[model samples]
Target: MSPPDTDLLHSLSAELSERLKDLLDQALLGMIRPNSASQFAQHAPELENFREAITHSDAKDDMDFLRNFREFVPTTNYEPYRPYIAKFFATPCKESDVKNMFAPGLPYCLAVSSMTSGKSAKTFPTYRPAPHLLHHPLYLSFPHSEGSTLSPSSLGLWQVLTVECEDGQSSKVLPVCAVTVGFQRMQMNWEVEHDKDRIDLWVPGKTDPFAISLVKSYRAFFILNALFALSDRRVATIRFLFASVFVNFLQYVEEEWPLLVDCIEKGIIPDMENVDHVRESLEKHFTANPLRAAELREIGPPGIQGWAVRVWPDLKMFIGITGGSSAASVPKVTHVLGPSVTMQAPCYGSSECFIGLPYYNGDPNTDFKVLPVDGVIEFLDVHSDEPFERVLSAWELVGGGHYEPVLTTRSGLWRYRIGDVVTVKGFAPDDGLPVINYLHRRNGGLEMAFGVTACTESQLTNAIVSASKRSIGQIIDFTIVGDERDTPITYGYLVEIGGEVGEDAKMAIEQTFEDLMANNEFRVAFWQGRARKPTIRLVKKGTFTEYRRQKCDKTNISMGQVKVPIILSDSTSKEWFLQRVIMEL
Candidate 1:
């Protein structure tokens, strides 16, 4: 029943050829996308300047064929992270130390320690506002086990509906990450009513091809990382060699010809399985009541499928998705203008820096501009022994830039270090302002966030210390993990036991957190909009180390490289309760 070895080789060759052909086509399209660009200029005012950039290349770069097929960049605001340098509080700011800092009309930032959600979120508006109730869970969706599988929510800022179905009904809708599709299956959810000239937002599951195929290619990158890191020495070496060769081939595809990535490209093949994690995850969450999605009794008063949300009344199942970096159906924001948008992927910040965000002219379909506030960014030599933070002694309410932002807002911030690396992309032509890009997160600043300004581990530690009366010795250590992203309840963290605290003591600690956070001013300012209580788990000794090891192994990262690990997982983070380590994994 097995295919012959010759046939398998032939099949792979054909697949490779097909992939190559598609890449070539996309590349051609990207280069000559003049017609599309020409048409867009009339509608979007922001593109007025870029029109020259669009037509700058008379001939294809040929080199950028694959990396940037069709010369099209889906308007995004991802750039390098900003490094933190909160220098105002060289010493921890006590309540009194900051009491006189506030004046009328001055922004009173309530920075809290990130130990417990109540303290961190309740202490800041960004962490616990109404929007946060929708976005916080997203911080919990991507598991280290799952490679780059994110809900489409993070793409909410740039959602564009570009498809139409047979039925003659259509309206702009946000992406799945922003709101639920009400359909049990993502496939059905993508079925949109038709519109005459409007772009459709109802993207079918991966089956429809186009962007899905491009997403599928990402799996290869993930596999490459895994193969490169395999425990087997010889095998890993061989895989690396093969990967190097493939990289050359891929480079050829990117540089010479670029159109093949799209499923819609001529001769492009289907590879739906590679990019269906978002839909599949949704299914796993709702398979118990599969029929719940079939509430479209056409004659009935707008059934469940008619709304963005649906309920399986009998099973008491409520289905929704947390938005992140997935490619899925969403609405078009052609009319919103650009100021409201922020890029998702390359948010600017690092360990010593904490206040950088993405730049979208506020437009969802364009490149981002990085703008760091005076106190948001800082710089350090690559060989520095410790972070030498740079900051302004006072606040600059009016934005000014060029230097890496070194922030010390009301959040009780001192000379805190953010770790984002950056390069000056350019000065904004429109405003003559500086723009930045978010590189990867620096090695030492990563940590769990319940949407609380992406709170840091040390901040959380301080909060826990402030909340608990027990000595630090009683609590050896704790790890904060982001839980489910699209639920009534948001995040949960597990604590590894060190001291003699038992259930009674732990209960007392939880009460302490609730009492202090509920009453704290910073907590009130930050986490006022959230509703769920953060779940805390007390674990056995050494459990924390084991977790760190597994996490390190999973991420292919060395221990001590990153100070804290943020669990951006939607599934396991939400479901798995604490497992007592009778034995370590």
Candidate 2:
């Protein structure tokens, strides 16, 4: 099929923009309430039945409910699940003990946790059915697989959460970049028979082909998405994989602008690389677009500086989870995409459970409507004087309450502390459910020598970003670890830069970081000579990529299940990164 013309593309863009606007508007109006309630109503009873079958109790009252749940199935932390990581790696690999212990005789597929917290990865059983491709306010309908026994191919969009079920099925919930509709299928060489009950999947021994194909498809997707959006004069709101990945892509485009222009003008794929099948459709659109090339050149220079705005002038915002370790990349996104592009985290949760749905308001921090459907939510109020024992129910939560959410899901996790802390905003007007905003992870805060949390994840991220922007080169990735090599404990900031930094630049980076971080308890300790000043070090360009690779290798988990650890709390990981440091300040 021939590519759509500029005029047709413009019309399509207008239609899409309107539809997107309508969907977002519905979300703000609490359209997600019914689904949350309905799902919860359905799952809550089934869970009760399961519990009754196990514990042999028909507890009906609230007192009975609390007693039965607490006594039969005790609250849990990540430590209890850590041993299960080895279950996946054992000879003649078997299911985890937690799986049998919690939900005995229940079939489940392991959803590998994104190891954002530390080096260890947690394997959680998923009993919830895959999300259907239905028109719902809380979700965006896109081309995706129906269901499968196999987990998402490591080659698939790892950034998007994939829910794998025991009943030979898998489904992705989040709306990632929509352009790669058939890319996964093509990469895996899988045939989807619409008539069949389940899809046949394969595990590839080598993933290089899929990885190469994905890169090509994404490059084309970005360029074409921007090109058409530019022609249509519409601001496109796209979900990005990460700010760091986007930054890296922009850098590549800037470096190879001439080649890109030449390829587009000649209707050829750049660096072909056996990805012809992947880029075939994209190439058709790129065909002899000299006019488009000229327009692209006229907009701005081929670099990060105002480049995104120049290419995608109507680009509205980049939606992503910018909390936790991903915070540092926000400044880079602003620098590249220009300051006008709003960065928003519409949804919040982890692999363990999908806790919150997007609740749009005027506030800068996106409000999430607590949807305790697939999972039952219990809040541990962090602000209470007697915090440990006082775990509050979801409905009992009040505005201005600070909480650490505990989840009990169909997966058989009973009151599991998810390691996150959130601040309760007001309740949702329609449902009266507590609307919350993510604050930070409990363990992500920077600890000082005197056992005081001097800086939060956001504060620490800001300091690193600010320092890098001022003195260090463009940051590719970074991590901070507690340095306890000596008596006066300090933290180490290891950053991977795009370019080399001089000795003066290194000292300036460290000094700038110290100044930015001085507003906290660490400053007082530093002034009193009780604590050593924090150190900054530069790692190799691909240090983070290597780290992720090593993690995958060690755990026998897919690359999709790993993330660049922001706060290296584990001694082994800290020592590994420290050994790879090229320079220190």
Candidate 3:
């Protein structure tokens, strides 16, 4: 059943919370193990036929779907086939094409893949029979539906809609337009005509929207734009809004604390972005209730511990993506939002396909049940030497096993290796499907001693966060690069912080990083004098931002999608970062 239309003013009502919770519970009721198995079997014929048809040019009669897929399908990489994929589908309109180049004839809309893979964005499409090909007799009974009900991959929209907002409005509003802040985009509109269910702060966009170009300068301008465009009611709700990405949220708060306080302490909208109507509306709202400003100040500053709920008493949850590498930033976000806001990853997916649904009773890591209806999934054991040949199906996965997923989708991507490694937590009691948690990217980590012991991006990020919190004040950004010049071959850490860190503090941080990695087998190699100790070098504060700007200019990709390469692989990029080192931390 659809949730009752809630007033933004009455978001904190107990009635509303219970209703939303009940809706979520009903959605999870039908996901039984037998049902999941039946769903997989139902899609098997379509999956097998698609695989066969795509590889027909290089047909192998007795080819095994698991083992021989690599031999028949062209390159698994999506770059070269872009032109063909676009041409294969029909256009929405002859004169005006889709912005992301999704063909109108496809069953579902194209979702933009996250550029977090350190590669350009690719269009993620799912199963559908080609319109022209449907004229054949065999295709007569095929369904002419728009698409499946399930959103392709980790859409994260469900969390936004159900999670209680301070103003009682669903996070989404139809009239909300994309507000560009430097290279980043915010889900807000400054126009006079806007939906009544307006968002107070940032909301998740089509992309994560945490671009590399959103530095201090851009943040300052973004704050001013927000202040000028919003009135007392919207400004009052600032303390309750959830940002799409944790780092982006933290940066925004750090840069705009003073402005936030001013809006609360006094119900005044500064005339900055020429939105006079907003200022007048706020003045009228404040005039009606002169004591509202004082009442808001009584709750105290949001930057302080436990102030999130105190500032906005009705706020139910802080929903956003805080898993994977961004896990380190959770504590900081919680410190501001307080423990009342329930933060969660909600689902697991990628640019390629929406893979899993959130298991409600799962662990805090947000384990998900693989949705067989999305596509045919194959699990490759991470520890296996010959992973391809030993690929496991959905039912073949065992609890505690780490496997990289290979998906065969209707969009014509057969046996496409997703590169992400997910750990099989266990099967859900209700649904017999494997419950999995995303671990890290296969090759995306700090390499040690010719791949003897590589640390995942999250591990590296955790070490940096822990060490920085103990010694250095806070880090702006960081990256790990291989130091091939050293005889023993050590790793070099490039860190950017607000101010200088003393030698003693730097030494303490480096030691702490080593101590944190004591559990890893790399410690034995280090003690045996094989792998040298990693060094930490402090770069200028804006070095990473400058690198991103240069990269965007060179690659000609949108600056908004550019992400900092956590592990510097190329010699040219490594040299560029090394050249800007200010001190050896």
Candidate 4:
């Protein structure tokens, strides 16, 4: 007999509550840990004030909470390093001087100047550089494509970091030294020009193969540049390398590791114009660096942990997303970067909203702390049948509940459903504000027989993670495809193994799946009277790379911007994966 509706809801609520309580306990433990607390105290020396600011009675509104949080925390706007940036600009330098300032073999030099008048004046200040002299500031660029989700806010943040200074400090010199990515060209329409200035760093046009190659080379270039900068001791200390997630960074490293190792062994920098030369040089380098040669040949683990430990030992922190696929890759990243590096989540944000909230360090359960100043955030109870009518404010959310984020942003996105489902881990100690973690995309799920059984991306991820841990061979990436054409619908998984997988590893993966389906009632129900077993396809190496390339070709998205879509929602994407399927279980 089917379970009663009320009973099902109660059971789900209880389960959610229990899970949340467990997460809250873990978060509390992390926060109050003797060593962690002591270290935070030592760094800030205002622990009590920070805690009190959040809990203060008058701190009832979002703006009030944001003001208190910003005052307590060291933000991107933190002024301690402002003077260092200012000092660099104060010294007069030419274009050549600016170019030569960067260490030899670095790919790009810093480009800095005060904002120009008119159009530039609106977004930036009107301070000019000395005549015939160029200033070197930290500038990084990315490929900008129309309709892409890359946030303009991130670029704006870079500008703020470089230009904004502490109150009452009257230095015309913008203290932070960094340039926002992308540039504007005259040929583009006025709207495009304004958008490019606000959003992009690189000038948009026909795709330059060389520029594409350079963009692909950025990860290696960044590491090499950091090492060179560290050697000179002129630039500020390399404290944190920030990105959306370490996984994306790891993928770039994995692709370029062999080439980079070749350069190091040959003691020569790679020439962008000559791919053949680079390959030949790498071949010669491998003869001498046999140890690295062997490591590279063995697809043991994801990431360049060994090289990072050896080269960037002083690198202290990695700030990025710790949710979704990024979280799955954390163990591998941790194993590679080692304990010296502190992995931190800077904040939660998206293309629509630039900054959301601060992430609680060491709390895997809590995704991010909401920024009261950013926008109005509402939650629709995900468990309720009519979730839209059951809207809850940030303060109104209870611990252990799941909800869909509905954001009304300052940037003109009104009541926009960000399509993210969040789980409330718990409330902050002082003001009782909810701490949430991104669970999965709202639409990230597969339905069988019109919702007779459904599996979400989160569930699939969990199962894959469990399977990987149980298997002897390391699986790098995977995607799920549902076949509804069959009488009993069958789900197929295309998995990429890090190295060659034998029968034992394959059996282990299959067995793990069997165990998971057996344990999950929803999965079991979905499969009941249909195919009892789902098929597993072990894809050959380089399959995902090819998939990404193809995706970029079809979508007009830059190769740099293409992400591995975990869910194949459409027939085209699904067929693409199906064609690449190598084996079936």
* TM-score for all models, in order of appearance: 0.26, 0.65, 0.60, 0.55
Best-matching candidate per TM-score: 2
Error of 3 at 465 (Å): 3.9
The parts of candidate 3 lying over 4 Å away from their true place are: 1-75, 86-104, 107-110, 125-244, 260-302, 410-412, 447-453, 466-477, 483-487, 496-504, 507-530, 538-565, 570-583
- For candidate 2, what is the lDDT? 0.53
Sort the predicted structures by TM-score, highest score first: 2, 3, 4, 1
CA lDDT of every candidate: 0.28, 0.53, 0.47, 0.43
* Model 1, span 1-585: residue lDDT tens: 111221111112334445534543443343223323222222333334344444554435544422232133222111111111121122432322222222111111222222111111112101111222223222222212111211221111111222222243542221211111111112222322322121222232111212221222332322222211111111100111111122222232232222222211222232333444333322222212112212322112211131211111111111121011111101111011122222232233322223333344432111234332212222333333445332321111112222323332212222234443333444343333334433323432223233333333333444443433442223434445543443434334455433355434545445534643553432553365542445555656554334433443343221222122333333342233255523211
What are the runs in model 4 whose C-alpha is more than 4 Å off? 1-258, 262-307, 361-366, 386-388, 484-486, 508-527, 553-561
Candidate 4's residue-wise lDDT over 475-539, tens digit each? Answer: 66677777665656655677776645645656655664665575465555655664445557777
Misplaced by over 4 Å in model 2 are: 1-67, 70-73, 79-109, 128-235, 272-288, 300-305, 364-366, 383-388, 445-455, 466-477, 483-487, 496-528, 538-562, 569-585
Model 3 poorest 10 in a row by lDDT:
150-159
lDDT tens readout by residue for model 2, 96-201: 2223433433223455566666654456644423344112323321112121111112333322323333443443232111212222332333323321221221
Angstrom error at residue 204, model 1: 60
lDDT score, residue 552, model 4? 36
User: Which ten contiguous residues of candidate 4 have the minimum total lDDT?
Assistant: 116-125
